[model samples]
Target: MIRPPALRPGSRVALVAAAGPLPPGGVERAMDRVRAFGWEPVAGRFCRGRCSGYLAGTDDERAADLDAALADPGLDAIWFLRGGYGTMRILDRIGWPALAAHPKALIGFSDNTAVHLAAQRAGVVSFHGPHPHTAEFPDFARDTFLPVLTEPRPAGVLPFPAGSAGRAEALVEGQAEGPLLGGNLSLVASTLGTPFAIQPRGAILFMEEVGEHVYRLDRLLSHLKLAGVLDAVAGIAIGAFSEVPDEGSDGRPTVRELLQDRLGGLGVPIAFGFPFGHVDDNWTLPMGVRARLDAGAGTLELLEPAVAERG
Candidate 1:
């Protein structure tokens, strides 16, 4: 994968709502944070509003905004306003090859996974990081994020903040290293039979989800299992499965129970709860970088730098 240049203090970042429509006041909020981060915020034509439905605008307009950002020689990076349900719809509309000529950091996760897959195809490293919303990231997320993008050094071993039980827990015991890939479970599952499917032949798959029922999660994982995705990964790192419902009592499995049942038989390193999902303390993961997963220790370490260092 091609390492993009590190973001500097005076960098210019373009904010576009390529996925779901922005919530009211979201653009102004994000613009404030962009300035606080020391980058000039350039809003796309559709960035400030929503359309008739869930999308930020028509596919053509959204595609134009994103394509413009990728083709612009002035913007240092492209950061999404938010992640919702429209990115996958515009995959065909994106000029994927243009990214190679003007490689820059592309940020956002969840529904944004589709874009990340396309960026990976273009051989550019992209960040599975926080959005450019008005809300300030917690100290943990902010501190852990800054160095990875600005330093051009390997993020090295990610530090897990202490928790009541533990920051991370081992589900399967072993150690494996590979390029980290994967985002939201639903997005990963959606790509199973598509041209943009995740090729997990030797990747450390990281997954997280929110607000889904156990049965749906089961179906998604089952799809991966049937497709040989579960069997092919070098390791698995699970993050927060936030705010899922625990309703209905038909002997359904809880999230942890379901995970163990689905992933335990793989004989690969597996760990859960590393704080990178729909939460306040999210960790920014650079897709397509070498990372080490130590299941016994429940630790994930970056094996290589995520960006090219400027002299």
Candidate 2:
């Protein structure tokens, strides 16, 4: 994988909302995150100023805005404003290969998963991290966020937050190593057979979701199985499935039960609830970089730096 140059203090990070419109208070928090990392926040016009429905702008307009940022030689990184919906619509329109020519860290999750897959296809390593466009930025998120980008060395084993919220359990016992791939479950599933479809062969597959019912989660995993995505990965690390609606009285499986039913038989190392999702305590994961997943130990460790020492 082509690691972008290490994000240093004073680095200019372009802020983009390629999917959803940023809430009024969201942009300030995003700026605060940028400043917290000691990077200059360079905001795009549409991410904050305009929105056509849930989209930040029309497909063509959003593509052009993102392309302009990618072409800027002065920019050291591109952090997404938020990931609600829309990046999948403009995936083909954006220039992924050009991003390789001007490689830099691409950071965000949720709807931004489409862009992450595109970046991986272009052979550039991207960060599956929290967005700059957020109404709330928790302190726990910064524990690993700042160091992973600023330090050029391997991030080592990631630290989950304290209490029951940080607990991760092993679904299958074993250890596996490979490049990390995958993001928001629905967004990743949406790219099946597309040009930017996830190529997870020999990769550690990670997935998470939000606002989904148990059945919907089952269908998404079923989609991956049908597409042979589940069969190709070295291991699976399932992140938080936040806010899943309770299915009352039916004989339907619960979210955890559904996950175990679908994946437990795959015979690969599997761990459940390793942070990263539509939650406050998100760990910044570097996609396409080598990593180790010890399912029994419930740990995911970076094998190498996600960035370079020199540009």
Candidate 3:
């Protein structure tokens, strides 16, 4: 995988809204955070634009903003402002060749999973981390994120919070090493049969979601199973599925039971409740980088640097 240049102190970071419209003052707050990190933030032309009820702008508008950001050599990274929906609409519209020619770190998760999958298919590395609109930018998130972008070394060990019962558990205890892949479960499932569909073969698939009911989760997991994703992966890392109800009616299983029923028999190293989804301490994960999953140890460690050193 091609690693983008490490983000220097003065590097320009383009903030774009490739999905739903940004919340009021969302762009300002994001810009503030970027400046706080000592990097210059360049807002995309339509980053704050709103239209079509849910979309940030028309498909062409959103795509054009992203295309411009990717093509701009001055930009060291493109940090998505938010992720709600509409990414699929502009997925095919992105200039992949241009993006590949001027590669920069693409950061965001949730709906931005569409772009991350596309980046993987294009053989470039992107980042799955807290978006400006997703979290409150806790110290943990900043500490884990800034170093990966500014340093030229492996991200090292990523373990769940200490003494937190929400820490990851081994569903299938074992060890596996492979390039990290996957994102929001809903996006992963929705991309099936498309060019951007996640190819989990030989990858440590990481998945997370929010507000999805147990039955829906079951159906999506079933889809992946039937699609051969479960059997092809080197391992599995499950992240937070926040807002999923504890009960299901009509004889349906609860979220926990559904996860066990669907993924417990995968026979691969499986770690659940990883700290990378819609959580306050969402750690930045470098997609397409080789990483080790020690399910028994409840740890994921990147084996190589995610960014290229300055020449």
- Best candidate, lDDT-wise? 3
Per-model TM against the reference: 0.97, 0.96, 0.96
Candidate 2 error regions (>4 Å): 49-52, 165-167, 247-249
Off by over 4 Å in 3: 162-167, 246-252
Q: List the residue pairs that clash in candidate 3.
A: none
TM-score of 1: 0.97
Question: Residue-wise lDDT of candidate 3 within 76-180, one digit each (tens)?
Answer: 999999889999989888888776788899999999999999999888889999887543888778888888888889978875565576457888899999999
**Per-residue C-alpha lDDT of model 2 across residues 153-186, encoded as one tens digit per residue:** 9989988888754446889989999999999999
The residue-by-residue lDDT of candidate 1 on 19-48, one tens digit each, is 888878889999888898898899998786
Number of colliding residue pairs in model 1:
0
Lowest-scoring 10 consecutive residues by lDDT in candidate 2?
Answer: 246-255
Off by over 4 Å in 1: 162-166, 247-250
Specify the poorest-scoring 10-residue window by lDDT in model 1.
Answer: 159-168
